[model samples]
Target chain A: MTARNLLLGLLAVLIAAPAVIGAYPLAVLILVLHYAYLGIAWNVMMGFAGLLSLGHALYVGLGAYVAAALYASFGLPALLGAIPAAIVATLAGLGIGALGFRFRVNGVYFALLTIAFAEFTRILFDHMGWTGGSSGFFLPVEHGQLNPIALRGPPVLFYYVALVMTAGAFVLARSLMRSRLGYAWLAIREDPDSAAASGVDVFRARMAAVAVSSALTSLGGVFYAFYYNNMYPEQIFSMARSIEIILAPIIGGLGTLFGPVLGSFVLTLLGEGTTGLLEHFGWAAPGAKQVIYGLALLVIVMVQPAGLWPWLAKRLRIGRDG
Target chain B: MTVYLDIVASGVLTGLVYGLMALGLSVIFGVVRVVNFAHGELTVAAMYMAWVMAGSLGVDPILTLPLIAAALFAIGYALQRHLVEPFIGRPEHEQFMLLLAVSIIVLNGLLLVFGPDARHVAVDYAYDSFELGPMLLDTVRVYAAAAAMVLALGLYLFFRFTDLGTAIRACADNLLGAQVVGLDVRRLYALTFGLGCALVGASGTLMVLMRDATPILAVQLTLLAFIVVIIGGLGSMAGALVGGVLIGVSEALAGFLLMPSLKSLFSYGLLILVLLLRPEGLMGRRA
Candidate 1:
């Protein structure tokens, strides 16, 4: 089957899922799609541009805090608040990218730089009074404020919104992968010095990747805040959170378009399944999900290396390049 | 002022332990060219082991040092030989991701076994402090710092003068060339990794003297070690010590002058500044 057809079929099933599945399963599906959105956003930078940022949570936390604060302080609509959140996250990404790229801090050093920035922002938020500091910020919900258009409604409503966002992100990623910028990002990823020698403008391409990826991630963050109705700096801007964002893309297949989406679904299901099994057996496994993720990554890296999605794609003859 | 001098003194002492924390990471990276993301977890595991020993056998945390070091050396050797050695020639990203996966597995495995609660080992002088003229010093901190200094110096000497250490350095400098010179590169890699873990184990035993052991502490320590190593230069032992002390003093000053929460901010800020302005670090040769 062609990749396009496979994606369309998946979308159809997802759109129809709310009708057949119970609320619990729908919530799980929402979580899966949430990760899919994040994974896709991360793939653009790490997979395509060869920029490994282990601290992408900086953008996510920034978007969440900004939208939540806007709603709480200025009584702005949460949907409208995402615009400013995206802008802020984009600017932050550009600043960080400029700092690292201009100084020639690539590879592992670049990843560490991203983590440091995220840590700095987390500390800043932890002490900021208006954002509620470590106490957390809660959004007020009124009796008549469950507007579907504004993303303030039931799980089903939010589920559809999440689906639309994920689909939109998938389309954006697909188009970007085919554009001139995408080719430039691939060249830079392979060899930046050679790419520059070939007149590809390495720094600009990298900065653009960071900017686009950060903006998309911020949108996911805004969605996360409204869906959860609260924001905690410790929870949102955590190293663990950043790790979780990258695992899907890596496991699905780095540098592939469908890898993040497929990986997110696989990981979320396995994670939820393991937790359910543990709960059913009356065992309290506090870190079972992480254990599963870690093991999967280890096994994949040791065995397949290219990730499950690309391997499966090759076997099934769906696409020549995942 | 006395306050300034006291803070500086405390910083230098704590810096010794931080320096020790970075030593193992530096050595591992120096020999194999692969950063061990699980390096911090090895320390956390050793701390837990020390805690268990102290609680069950009624021994001091310091007394469990030999057991922790021996056990960690074995684990590190086995890990490198079985898991990491195969990927030494792979792409750098694969190596990094593999180590990261190992870190996640070890951290979560620890959480599964020990739960999420923080565990600490109590010693006789945990809270005892002595006045040094105008300043006060915790006896436990002083002892831990002394131990750290000894270990750092020992490692420096080992790398400087020992035959095996010279072989390890040669492997780090040029892998194929080292092989051409008839060095048992694989065995040397495993030994270097084991030695690195032993150093971390020693630091972990000292850590139990001052801080609580929790699963989450692994990632924090890893990042701290990275900051120190980056500031000291990736594979430079002397750089790790100077960078560690500089970070320690800056953290103390930040906590004193600003909010306690901003201590990490100061360290991370300095890290970014160093990476931007001088990526070679204080004692490291320019790349």
Candidate 2:
């Protein structure tokens, strides 16, 4: 079957997923979609522009705080808060990207820059009394009601929201990968010096990638905040959170369109499965899931550096285009 | 004025330990050209090592420094030979992810083994203070700083004079050339990594004297070490020391002047400014 047909069929399955799965599984799927969405957003930079940002949590935290704070303080609906969330996150991304690119901080240094910014922002949020400081910023939960506008209510509402987000991000990433700017990004990714020599506007392409990626990720952050009904600076802005966002794209396939989604599903399922097994055995520890993630990353990078999606796709002969 | 001096004094002492931590990172980066993303976790592991030794053997934390350093050296050597060697010339992201994975494992492994409680080493001199003029200094800080300084000096001398150190430096200078000249480049890389781990591990033992040891400190300490190395210069040994002291001083002052929680603000600000103005760092040779 064609990639298009496969995607369409998958969407159909996802639309009907909540109907088949129980509440717990549905919640897990929401998390899968969440990571899938984030992975796609992050893929724009690392997968496309060859910029390794180890701290995408910066944008996630920024977006969540912006939207959650606005909703909590001004009674602003999350739907409206998304715009400002995107803007604020985009600006922050632009600033970081500009600084790094302008100063020619490539590779690991660039990654460190992202980490520094994220940690810096986390500490800043921890001290901001308006947002409840380190104590945490909490949203008022609306019980037994559906309010998609304010993003308050049941899990089904969020499940669908997350679903739409994942689909939209996948489509957006695909289009962006095929666009003229995307071509430039690919060229720059291959060789920035050669791309510059060929008049590819490497800096601008890289900057644009960061901008788009951060903006998209911020929206995911908004969804997370409203769905969870609370935001903790420590948890939300942690390097662990950033690492979780990147694992899907890295594990599935770096540059492939289907990689992030596939990776997200595999990781979240494996994580939930492990958690379930561990809980059953009374071996449930806080860091066991993270340790599993780290091992998966290690094995993937060592064994299949190209990631699972590409390898699986090639083996299955599923999609030549993907 | 005395308060300022006192802060500076304490910052310098603490900074020396931080420098020792960053020095290991610098040395590893210098030779292996692979950033040990697990640097902080390794340090945390060392801190745990010290804590365990203190609790079990009833030995002073200082006595376990050499033992922890040796253990960490072996761990680093094994890590470099098996895990890090293959990814030497790979893409930066792959290298990062590999080390990041290792870091996650090490960090979470600590959590699993020790749980989430903060572990502190109680030395007989924990509350003892030394008065140098009007400024009072904690005995623990003084001992930690002195140990770190002596270790740093030893490292400096080793790099300057020893055959192994020279071989490592040669490997760092030109990998291909070193290989062509019949040098065991891979072995040297492993040795360099071991030395780096030892430095950080020793510093970790010192660190427990001044503060509590918690797995949660892994990420922050890692970033702090990175900041020290970056501000000092990525591959410069002396730069790590200078950068560490600078960061420690700035952190102490920021804690004093602003709220204590915002101390990292200044260090990050310094990092940004350095990245912008002089990416090679103050003491580093131009990359």
State the displacement of the C-alpha of residue A249, model 2, in Å, after optimal TM-score superposition: 0.5
Q: For the second chain of model 2, what is the TM-score against the true structure's chain B?
A: 0.96
How well is each residue in B153-251 modelled by candidate 2, as lDDT tens digits? Answer: 999899889998888889988878899989998898889999999998899999999888899899888888888887787656777888889988888
lDDT tens readout by residue for model 1, A63-175 = 99888888888877878999999999999999999989888777877888899899889988999998899899888766545786467888888899889988998889888
List, residue by residue over A1-322, the lDDT tens digit for candidate 2: 6788889999999999988899999999999999999999999999988899988999999999999999988999999999999999999999999989888777777888898888888888898889998999998886897778888878999999999999998889889989999889999988999999999988889989999999999999999999888889998998889999999999999988999999999999988888899999998788888888889999999999999998988886786566
Write down the TM-score of every candidate: 0.97, 0.97
lDDT of 1 at B195: 92
Candidate 2 wrong stretches, greater than 4 Å: B280-287
In angstroms, give how far residue A19 of model 1 lies from its true place. 0.1
Q: How well does candidate 2 match the true structure, expressed as C-alpha RMSD?
A: 1.5
RMSD to the native, candidate 1? 1.6
